[model samples]
Target: MTAIFRTERLTLVFLVLTITAICGLPLLLLFKIGLTAEGSLNIAPLLEALQSRSVLRALWHSLESSALSALFATILGTALALVIGLTNVRAKGLLVFLILLPMMIPPHVTAIAWIQALGPASPVLRWLSIAPELGSDHPLYSREGLVLLLTLQHSPLVFLLVRAALRSFPRELSDAARVSGSGATRMLVKITLPLLSPALMAGFALAFVAALGNFGINALIGIPARYTTLPVLVWRRLASFGPDVLPNVAIISVILALVALVAIVIQTVLQKRMRSALVGLPQAPLDIALGKHRLPVEALLWLFVASVLLLPAASLLATSLVKTYGLDLSLETLTLSNFAEVLWRQSVTLRAFANSTGIATLAALVIAGLSILLGYFLVSRKAGQRLMAGIAGSQAEIAFAVPGLVMSIAFILAFIRPLPIVNISLYGTLWIILIAYVSCFVAVGLKPVVAAFLQMDMSLEDAARVSGAGFGRRIRKIFAPLVAPAAASGGILVFLTAYNEVTVSALLWSTGNETIGTTIFNYEDGGYTTLAAAMSVVVVLATIVIMVAMNALTKKVPAGTIPWRS
Candidate 1:
């Protein structure tokens, strides 16, 4: 009890308070608001809100779109994983990297880029002489287009998870299957695919939840399509009408939460049903000889990547270089003014860049510092270790599990007022958004750190403590260096996530506190699609550099410390 926490009392207390404030408090607030009207117990308001026509429509739309998107993403992403993970593909590392690039692009940016590439003014479409005729409505303004964008956005996630599963697949079984005179196709169907059920289910669940909570693509594309998902509907209602709609928004949040919960439960049940039944060290992944098919397979893979990734990216680049959205691309029509406007000309854009960078970096550093301590507790033999770990894990999970926009709304309700002692409001200042980012990304920062701790050797830490070093000194001198690599990787994850964030910031930002995500969205909303595209180009290039730099850094860390590294 106290003896166990004596040396790390302050850190322990900080963890408890942070978790309670960020996750527990918001949830308790949601319950209070959603279940109450006029500060009294009442289910009438909640029931009414639930039964409203618009609310029912949104719930159905959310369910239908997310389920379809996850299904499509899983099928496509699993195919890529099978090809890249099981086949003897050339430059597998590079291929996987390119394939996962779409996942790294922020959803709103993806929406903007796709719009730039496919709109009537598309330079490529016009050059190809297939541009849609002017005065006709945009083709993508429908539910199908939203689902398409969501599928593309989430497929990389499925691919990453499935590939990881395949990498550790037991080769012993494959070798046995092969020695039994079984053909490659037959072995794959009878032995391999069945074992992959768990991984496939897990990937689908992740994508499903991701699509359920997605706000960016839905906001930009969904609104135009006149298709309102929960997140977008909440954001629009809250923004247009202000706090008066808080009760209604809270009710919608509850529905979304229930949908997310059901998806998780189903995934868990399905995964538990059929164990792979091979528990020992996983052999190297079984590589089936492509024989004469290797060249065509590689070409087909590249072509898919090119269509999904390259064309839209080129369209984005061309749009950025042009003077307006949908302008035909040509040497004479190209200009750098759009880039200049966002990067150097507009003072507000410059301010936004500075604001988002500073905020994201600050949040990353704070979360990293906290995660380092939290990781210690997760592995330490302290009293109440299980209890503390359970609370810590749940809090982090809930904060990240809910959609960013929903979390933002919860934070708004939680901290819109001034504090008691300082009497200062966090709502309109930079602190509010920074606080939101920390709350939203705590789980992300913890994942790699927890993974690193799971693989750490406790022997060195014991040895250091036996030599009379204090707990603080042991942590600073011994454990910190060992886990620093993973911590750095996790911190970068947080930084990149917070930097490219739009859903959370879209609501939390004020006039002077505009973030990069808010800035890009504002441009798009104001009919400056080219300006938005230029800004997105900057983000995409920066994200690539950051990811590449992160990949290089992970080379020194343990294998599994960086989730994407493997």
Candidate 2:
């Protein structure tokens, strides 16, 4: 008993220290540096940054693009959720999966795919004889184009949230409305929309924050368009001026972080108020009979899905097969050399693939292990255990809620200096990127385990305890087995998310530590369009394969453990 108690206390301390070091300390250091000058409290730098024309311009651009993109995404996502979630759509599972597919794909890959799809030399467009003339500006290289891609990238996020909300919608009220002779259109407009307002607001806020911190689309498209947003501005500043301008960059990051935090708070308040205004007994969601309109609606939905998914994919594949950019796809022009170059010839590509695979694997395993331990305390009856869990959970949530770029900046500030006791720098090493991945995705990996723990029967643990099993013994022998599937699912989720993600690793990657995402981005940025296309095609296929594997585990884990599956 004494040993068990000592072990528990030590575990609690370790959890607290680990989470604080990786998640809490970085953001705290970021705020400290942003709000102070030479270790003294000062707002002068922040004020000057706000007053700078370039900073102000970037800020406005960020807000404008985010707002517009979010607004459009909310409309699109909500519409899809309503049609698919409520009505009897054909292949409902497939539709939901496709809708969520874009969200799973890294934004930079989406950007690259879309860039190829719409460029002057777009194979699809050219084959259709609608390609823009050579030397014409690519249509997507402007503020509007940035918003369009951002909208497409984030709409799936909104779709997921709204669809979940729809699943919990009160069917009894809708039935009553129908019994009262309310038409579908009128009831949908009056009752359903009113009740779904909270979700709509929540979706908009989520989309807004996502767009505000978006780096890939903003950088890839906006740079050529000369439309600078805060995230891009920070990257450009740091990349161009080096760490000598860390203070200015930190201030800009703080601004971006504050905006994201404010959006979250606003969403929470609005969702709560709207939720409080309505009350209903839980029931199955509505399944309205579309009757004659069903076929056309399904056709429209499929058309929309194909336009978004297939067009870019076809363009990407076509681009990769071509021998060079700006060449039409033909028997003479089509070649496998681009894929060969990226897959085998380019040493950087091979190294990046290995680095990303290794880092993502390690991060996944570490997060999965931590999730199991932390999730146990999250559901523990003891106050001390729960307290530790709460602290760790809140930090993870805040880390995840902010933009990845913001988190990257926080990490930069936190790790640029050597550790206190170890006296070693992690700033330019892959270690920093790995640590950042664990911190950023902790919430992602913990969620499923927490869900599993919530659903678990406590009798097993009680029986183990009655048998004189220690806490560690009980967890290892009993709880661990029960939640292994959920933990695995969570780990897979983390791997998929971090595998090709550029945001968190964008600033952290050094010469030898190039991640797959950074490598692809570099290829595209450096005018190696065919090479980028080939790598992106590979990434997309790999992502689909992993997602399919997770999909196979749908029956083993909790219902919502797999987002696309649920």
Candidate 3:
């Protein structure tokens, strides 16, 4: 009994220390630096930042773009979700996959693709002989352009959340409405929309937060347009001034974090106020008969899919094949030199690929292993165990909720100095980026494992305990096997996200530690647009392949474990 108590106590301590170090400490340091000056309590930095014209302008721009983009995303995503969820849309599976594709693809990659797709040299437009004249200033370099790209980038998130909500909708409401002679349109406005308000609010808040933190669109489009947002402003300050301006940048990051937190809090309150519980079990989504309107609706839906997915993809492929930017695509102008350069000739690109793969893999595996232990405690019967797990989980959720850029700044602030005992500094190394990835993605990796644990039968572990099985033995022989698939799913998600994202690694990446995202971004920013396009094409393909592979595991895992699965 004493041994068992010691084991549990040790586990709790270890989890607390790990969570505090990885998730809590960096954020605490960030706040410390942002809110203090020279080891003393001070608001001067925050006040000075707020009073700067550039900072104020960027803050306003951030709020404006995020709000507009999220509004568009909510309306478009909800309409699409309704069409697919409440109608007899053909190829629903394919449509869902295509809609969700944008979310999986890195935002920078999407920005690059859209830039190429709409540029004066757009291969698709050129082929149709409708291309914009050369030197006709690129249209997507403005505030409107930033919001447009952000909308396209985040609409998929809203779609997925709203779709998931729709799946749980009770059929009784639809039946009740129809039995009262409500027309489809009227029924939708009065009944369906009201019921979906909570989801709509949630989706809107999600999109707002995502757009607010978006560094890719803000940099790629906003920079040229001379319209800056808070994230891009932070990046520019850090890049232009270096760490000499660390205090100022940290203050800016705090502003960004506060904005995100406010949005989340607003969403939470709205959702709570708007939620309407149904008394019946969840049923299949509504299948409203579109009748004669079906053909037109289907055409519109497919056209949207083509516009969002096919156009950019075709443009990206064409640009990659071209020997140089602005070249007309033909056998004469086409070459694979760009791809070859990035994939073979360029040592930097190759190094980045290797570094990202190694770091992301390590982060994923560590998070998965931690999730298993955390999941065990979260599902344990003891109140103390559950409380410890809850605190750890809440901290993780807070870390994940913080913007990636802010998290990057937090990590820089935390680890820029050497450790007290070991006297080793992690700054300017791949180790810092790896730790940041784990911190930023803890919630993501833990979520599915918790779900799996909740669904599991506890009796197996109880039986093993009765038969004299120790904690580790029961976990190893019983719990781990049952939750293995969920762990794998979570690990894959972490890898895909950490592997493709540039935001967290943006300021952290150095010469030899370049990540795939930062490398690609650098290529585009450095006039190597063709190489950027080629690499983005590769990333898109890799992302699709990974998602498909996860789909193959649907039968083994619990229902809803794989997001793309029905």
Candidate 4:
């Protein structure tokens, strides 16, 4: 009994510290900065700086862009969900994959690809003879362009959420409405739209938070256009030379965090309502026939798929192979020189690849183990369960709202100073970056495991306990085997996200440590488009291979062995 209690206590302590270090420490640093004095550890000046005019303007711009992007994504995403989910669509699986492709490619990569496709010397525009001037005259760098890119990239998230809701929809209600002589448009507007409202709101809230926190797209598009969103402004403040700049930056980050908290609260409320309303509703499978419009509908769907999925990727491939942007494609021009340059000519790219892979892999392993333990504790343990739930829930909400840049800044503020007791320096180390990745992505790892845990029958564990099986033994024998698939799914998600992540990685990067994201950024900045494209291709290929491997491993597991199957 003493041994079991000691083991449980030790596990709890480790988890608590890990959670605090990753999530709480950064926030504490931000608070310290906010309350501290200018040029010293004092708080009054920080409050005064919060009310500055430039800060207010930046906040307003951030809000405007976020709201616009969210609104656009919601409407467009709902339309896409209706088309794919409510209707009988041939090649539904392929269409769904197409929609998810944008997520697989990092946001920075998407921005760069878009710039290549829409630039003056781009092959598509040059071929059409509609190329505009390459500089300020082009509208691609404006707020409108940022909104467009964000909408395109993030709408898929809304689409997936709404589509899932729609898939579980009660088709009988729609059938009854049709029997009552309701017209297509009227039925959609009156019945379908109302039922989907909660989901729509939740999706919009998520999109809004994501847009508010987005740094990559804003940096690529908005910064050039002189549009200073909050994240960009925060970076600028951090990079600028001034004795008082650090505190001001901290103040701004706190404000952004507050806004994110509000957005999360609203999203939580909406999701709860959605779930409640959907309860007890019979989910009949929908198979809406296109009838006479099938051919045209299929054509439009294919066109959308091609435009969104294939065109940009194809453009990237072409640009990577060609000698120059506008050069015509030929056997002579298409060589592997760019790839060679990226891999061999520049040692930084290769080093960054190694750093990124190592850090991401380590972070994924740590976070996966933590998530599984957390899930187990929440499901099985009696003591501290409410605290555990609260902590896990808060982490998820904050992870969604706090942009990578904000978190990085918070980490710098928190850990740069000397903490003699700990006897360690966090800045510039791979450990710091790993911790940042784990903090930002731990929630992602937790969600799938928690879902799997919830579906599991506790009776198995109860039986084990009744048989006098200790906690560790029961977990090793029963829970671990049952939850392996979910853990793999979560770990793979964490690995992929950390692998392609750029926003936080960019902020925390140093000369000693670079990730693939920063490497691509450097190449793009140096006007090495071919090299950047090659690196981008490498990222995409690596992601696909990892996903394939994970899928195969999951396949080998026996059915119902994993809680996901149940």
Candidate 5:
């Protein structure tokens, strides 16, 4: 009995520390940096900056773009979900995979692809004369363009969430509605829409949050348009540090936190209403027939899938091979020189690639291990469950709103000044980068692990204990293998997120500490379009390979062992 209690306590402690490191430390650092010797935090300087007409204009511009994009994306995504979930769409498995492809590729990669496809010298643009005059800038580098790009990148998230809601829908209610002689459109607008209200609201909130916090798209397009969102503004401010730096950062952080909090509250209320509506209804399987309209619906679906997934990718591939962008596309003009220059001619690009992969891999491993242990504690241990639950539940909302650039700035302020006392300088070190990556991404890793843990049967662990198996032994023999796939899934996702991460890395990266993302940014800024494209291709290929390998390994594990299914 004493041994079991000790084991539980140990697990709880581990989880507390992990939460502190990932979530608490950054906020604490923010306060430490902004407060005076008397312990009073100041926001006057930051508020003054915010009061500027230009700053207010920029903020309004960002909010308007984000709101519009979210609204449009929610509608499109809801329509897609309805089509896929209600109708008999053939090759759904293939369609689902294609729909998810855009998410796998980074936003910067998508931007580059768009430029290549729509630029003045491209074959399609040449035919359409969409290219600008000699002194005109490209259309892809504007506020409207940014909205289109972000909408394309983030709409799939809405689709996935709403589709899940549709799948789990109670069909009896719909059947009752149909038997009442209601028209299809009326039933959809009244019954279906009301039923899926929570899902729709959640989708809108997620899209808005993503758009608000987005840095890559803004950096790629908005900067050229002279439009700065909060994340971009924070980055610029941090880069131009003075005595007012800490207060300015604190103000931005508070604004971001408030936005995130509002979204979370709205989501919670809607979700609770949805749950109440769903209570007492037996979940029935859903299969809506297309009833002779399948072909046309499928054609439209395929058009959307192709436009969102294949066009950008194909454009990037074509651009990478061409000797000069905007030149006429000819087989004779294709060369391997761009690839060579990125991979061989530039040592920094190659080194950054390796460094990013290695650091991300390590971070993933650490996150996976920590999350599993934490999940077990939360599920099996009783004493600290409430605390753990509170922390874990809020992790997603907090992480979603905490812009990567802001977190990096908080980290620098927290660590840079205090390191000398510890006889160590952490700034610009790989350890600092790793710490930042892990902290920024741990919430993503935790969600899957916690879900997997909840699905696991307590009986298995109980039996092990009854048979005299020790805590560590039971975990090693039963829990570890069962949860390995889920952990691996989380790890792979984290690795990909960290590897391709540009915003956080851009803030924290220093001389002699470049990541592939930063390297790509540098090449683009230096007007090395071919090299940037080449580097992007390499990163994409490597990411695809890693994803494939992780999926294969995950498949060999048991069905309920994976996070998504669980």
Candidate 6:
């Protein structure tokens, strides 16, 4: 019986139940509330919710903005990927790194930086003598701003996906085309574009989902523009009505979830087609010489990168240094008081930093440890491996695919009451947020581990079992060391993602439990732009330092563990 307790069936059951609880219960609760009212079947509520003017507008806004943003980002990102990926550009590695930096910065931070970079008091705009009129609303506080900022924030995701697909591209196809006297442009259009279509579709779908779920740009720009998306609508309902708005929030969440589901399905289909189309050894990138056009193209690419990367950074740095956001930088006006105020002087800021670090760290460690067990069970060659994998994978995918605002609402709906055993409420506390992060990021942490397990040699574990070692012994002594590197990498990913997470914590955080992301958002909403900039600078700098440290350690880990490595 003791041995049976640790059998494979037990492991599988435990994994399935954990996944269901984390992702399933919240989702189930959401649909139930949305599709029911007063313990009776009620399509009227859903129909009424859908028909409401605000809801209709939000739906249109979400769909319209996400579609446009995805289109723009896909075009720009695909172009950049083709140019840098295939061309014999100098410093290609560094250029790719810079292009990807925007993805690392949280969306809210990017919004804040851009707002500061182009507002009425912008140093850049002022220097160009095109700053908006004083006391005028921010030029970026509109629907157009949401579209632009969302595109910029999500373009890197498209770039990464498209570039990865291109890395596996067969050079022979292009070579054969070249033999037919196909020029560079002709080769690109004739051979490369056809093979890259699936990837392009996949990239566009990724960007669409990202933009649809984006809360930062919407919160900062959409609210001011009276442009409400589903994500922003969810946040507003919760803020304005709290828990009493659960039914309405659930209906909104269902709509958001449906949109996310459609995007994921599209992306998954395209990815399958992409994989089926390409199966061969990856070769050197097809080097296309730009000839006389080389310098101009390179300069153009750098200029775009600078606009997205450098301008926002310069804005944040300047804002943090100045006495106030509107003040010009000079020997007389320049000061670091905002930095001091946010970094050390304010108890809220200090507590936010500590709380965010603690919560993110806890979530990372818990997910890492669980991922080993989950990954092992997922990859086991058992009778029901495929079924188990499908169930677990879908749950993880759905949890991550939905917007943070929607997920936060689900958490509130599911956990607002006291626990069954302890009889203690988890709502209105950091514990709820912690639980949400675990559910939200479990997929991220498990990805590398599952990959690692797929490639691991099972002979060592088989030998350990033959030596009478139990599941605990084998895992602790054998699999632990083998899977540690992948687990560690995934943990870092979860930590980085959850640290500056604003959308999930926006509604979940309270006065004493503010996260770094929510703190920055709060400062901005309170008209403390400089203070917001200071905190954002801190978050971005820390994120970069962590990424650098990871880069240094990537060489030691197994290949293919890091997404950016390939």
Higher-ranked by TM-score: 3 or 6: 3
User: What's the C-alpha lDDT at position 449 in model 5?
Assistant: 76
**What lDDT does model 1 reach?**
0.85
Model 3 TM-score is 0.98
1-566 per-residue lDDT for model 5 (tens digits): 79976886676666676667666777676755454335676656556757977667767776877888888889888898788767778987667666756666777777777876666655545545665554567787777888898888778878888887876777777788778987668878987888888888889988887787777787778888888777777777776774257566666755655565677688888778775356445464346677788888899999988877666666667677878766555688788899998888778877897789899999999889877777776676465565675575465337545667667777677667546567787777777888888788887777677777788898998899899887788778988787877788888889988998887787778777899888887777677777787888888888777655665655544442322221
Question: What's the number of clashes in each of the models?
Answer: 1, 0, 0, 5, 1, 0
Poorly placed runs, candidate 2 (over 4 Å): 38-40, 277-281
User: How close is every model to the real structure, measured as TM-score?
Assistant: 0.96, 0.98, 0.98, 0.91, 0.92, 0.95
Better of 4 and 6 by lDDT: 6
Model 2, range 23-81, lDDT digits (tens) per residue?
Answer: 99999999999998778999988889899999999999999999999999999999999
* Native-structure RMSD, model 5: 2.8
- Regarding lDDT, does 1 or 6 come out ahead? 6
Report lDDT per candidate.
0.85, 0.92, 0.91, 0.77, 0.74, 0.86
Residue 537, candidate 1: C-alpha displacement in angstroms: 0.8
* Model 1 misplaced stretches (Cα beyond 4 Å): 1-5, 37-42
**Lowest summed lDDT window (length 10), candidate 3:** 556-565
Instruction: Write candidate 6's Cα lDDT for 58-168 as tens digits.
Output: 999999999999999999889989998899877787788788888878999999999889888887677678889989998888888889999998888888888887888
Clashing pairs in 6: none
